[model samples]
Target chain A: MDDGAPAGNAGRTRPGPTTARTRARVGRLVTRAGLELAALLRATGPYATHDPTGSRAATRGLPAGSAAPPPVPQARLALVVATAGALHGAVMGSFAGPLGALYSAAKIPLLLGLAPLVCVPSFRVVHAVLGLADDEPAARRAVLCSQATLALTLLALSPLLVVAYASSSRYHVAKLVNVGVFALAALAGQLTLARHYRPLLRKDRRHRLALVVWPTLHLFVALQLAYALRPFVGNPRFPTEFLRSDWMGNVYLDLLWSLRATLG
Target chain B: MPAFLDLDRLLRGESTRPETLREGRVDLSAPRLVLATLVCGAVFGLCLGLFAATGETSDGAWQLLSSALKVPLLFLLTLLVTFPSLYVFATLAGSRLTLLPTLRLLVGAVAVNGAVLASFGPVVAFFTLFTTSYPFIVLLDVAFFVLSGAVSLGFLSRAVGVLFGDAAQGGSQGRAKLVFRTWLLIYGVVGAQMGWLLRPFVGNPAMEFVLFRHRRDSTIFEALANLLRDLGDGWR
Candidate 1:
């Protein structure tokens, strides 16, 4: 009996390396899948239209001249920005565990896809109100530039964020800092859009109102979407779940409750 | 109405007249703002600390005193750690703001934060007096802090713009904007850690009043996670 037990124990220990190998394989598969998805997004995504010259000319308010600038493909810009955002999210998500990468990966498309969509109606309204209906192309360019700015800013900040997360012993502090970085990136993008929109608004005092309304609307939509797609970064206390069971609650209330529970 | 009350106007890029920030035509000095900030911060901290210690406790006075001291200390330490780096970055970005004005503006920001905190003192005290739920009080305190901090940051942005004039705006001002955002991040991280280190601001009525607890191995995140787990279990 004792001999048999020893043999069984040895057999059990043998699976350790097998599991590790399996994990490595899984990681590779996930990476391959992600790349494929990115390529697909680049190819067929609605955001991947090729109209760089029109966008550039409209944003700069430059008149058409004999020597038009070369057209920059929108697909390339979208692909680059989406990849950067996903990478940043993945790096931050790694702090939680392997599952965090999946959560964050899911978040990337939602954020990139939804934010601009949220702003579209507002953009249309503003354009109509400002009597810039004819300037729709310019407005579209402004929006794209703003998004690209946000993505690039996030990409630049990712290294610093990774370092901060790795070094910080405190999870609360790290999480807060991560949120702050994201907020700053979003603000930077919005400001860039506002700058582009200013000349288009003809220095109207209503420009301020439009700026506030658009961002506020965008944030509200983004926050709701984020809440719905919960667990972008898994909580250390609980096992990773793709979506929280109680995901219907208000984010502000969650913040309040979480603060009370943790600090009070 | 005073310029400070017109936050919307400020957000629209309207500048507060220089006379408002000056003393009899003399520009506001760093030392003056620093002194004023410290005083206001102390008042705000005292109100919060006292309210936190209101539960039945053997050492209520000690708890209140320590809480007050720690709150202001958190702000002061964050400022000290971030100021030099911010100044260097601003200068590198070609901001004409000298060290003195930068210090004044930062300290003034803290003062505005303190004022906002004080404004919520009555609401905090009311909850403390009536509610025995510790977590609820803690959450309310945090919410208040976030609200005040955001308002203060808005003021800081406007103040920087006013001080730097046109140089504070446009693409060329990217570096300066980056520095400001970085400083805000640093302040937040340092402040959170400090708050964690000097914790139990609202003493558990059953426990003895100890100024500082023995150091724990767990990080604030770990503690938060554990608390959340406990709450989840209770709910289930």
Candidate 2:
């Protein structure tokens, strides 16, 4: 599972290809890139109203009471979450090998998609208690939008990950870079959630409370799950495993110990 | 987590607004408020105890446990000691607020305090990881406590002002506020003393694990002064 090997072979094979074969390969790559870009635009489009199932049209047919955008279909949003998550995860694990890439690709979609599922029931109860139950559907959509935004942001950031992995074989540096990217993406997601919740907030001030509480709950779960889903960068010294043996350890405590070792 | 939403409303001034307080009670669930306080307090306590856990001591785990338990205990016990006096004086000051509402308000304030402390958990943990200096972590945690203390007091005083702000109770409102101000000072001192009694929250590497340190001759203020001096010496 040597990551460098395939790229090294690609470099060595570049000059040996005949000119006609090179042109055909380049044409295929161009078509693939075009399709990927279209998919990305569809995922990240701020006003993605082109619902093929006519559900968004049905939403519009109802006399609109608020200026909030129509909710994207749950299935489509789930697709975006999984696809974008896997794209970023694949690059994140590229420093390991194909198997490592597959494992991470699978784990990231779970991270992006499942963490919110874990949080939704409690959040719904919170919304009900706050007397904002009527707005809960919109709030759930906001959450979905935020998750989609986070995944798309990560997908957008995968190139930087590639650059970072190329420059550093050091696992610690790789981990740090991954952290920086995720933090930036999470910030984007929070901002998106806030923006989406703004319409609801105007209708009811209590939505403001849920806006802050949701992120706090989400990040608490997400961070711990990330800690459990360790070995994302696959330290070169160790075998490329899906998780470390002691994956269930407390993340905050582990972070403290690591920091002390590094700085003290 | 819903309990945290109650704190969110408190911090946002939504729950403590003049209109809301006029209804004669804060909108906080009693059980949730207590749960939030304990969880948030324990979260910060875990962060605080990280210094010891990462230090050259075998009592690291015990330190975390003690610190977690002591933090909530420190705040709740301090409130228990000081609340009765505040309630009596507030009533004597011609306030119309009764016992249950006042207690709920104070508990809400403590939950806010806990929330603020928990938010700073990561920052404390970061510093804990970045430095092995015992004095520095102690001082850092003290500074955070001071900051959170000010926030909780601010919340309490504002809510009390609105609670006492009835047009008919104009003069007594000022008296109630004055009582609150005086009680704040007492609370601060008692909190410090209580924290001192619950010592070893951040386990010292030089010491072994103990639930309570021996009753010391020195006071909390003196210990703080010593920590400040020691921290300054380390810097130099």
Best by TM-score: 2
> Residue by residue across B79-173, what tens digits does model 2's lDDT show?
87677546544644545555556667888888888999899999999998898788888888998998998899888888877777663544866
- The list of candidate 2 runs beyond 4 A from truth reads A1-264, B166-170
Clashing pairs in 2: none
DockQ of candidate 1, scored on C-alphas against the true complex (2 decimals)? 0.01
Clashing pairs in 1: none
Worst 10 residues of 2 chain B by lDDT: B88-97
Over B1-236, each residue of candidate 1 has an lDDT whose tens digit, in order, gives 22232222223323234443322111333333455455555665666666546766757888777777766765676677566446544543434344444555676666666667767877877778887765556667767877888887877776655444445355445556667766776666655555566676666565788887635443445655665665567567
lDDT of each: 0.59, 0.74
lDDT of 2 at A3: 8
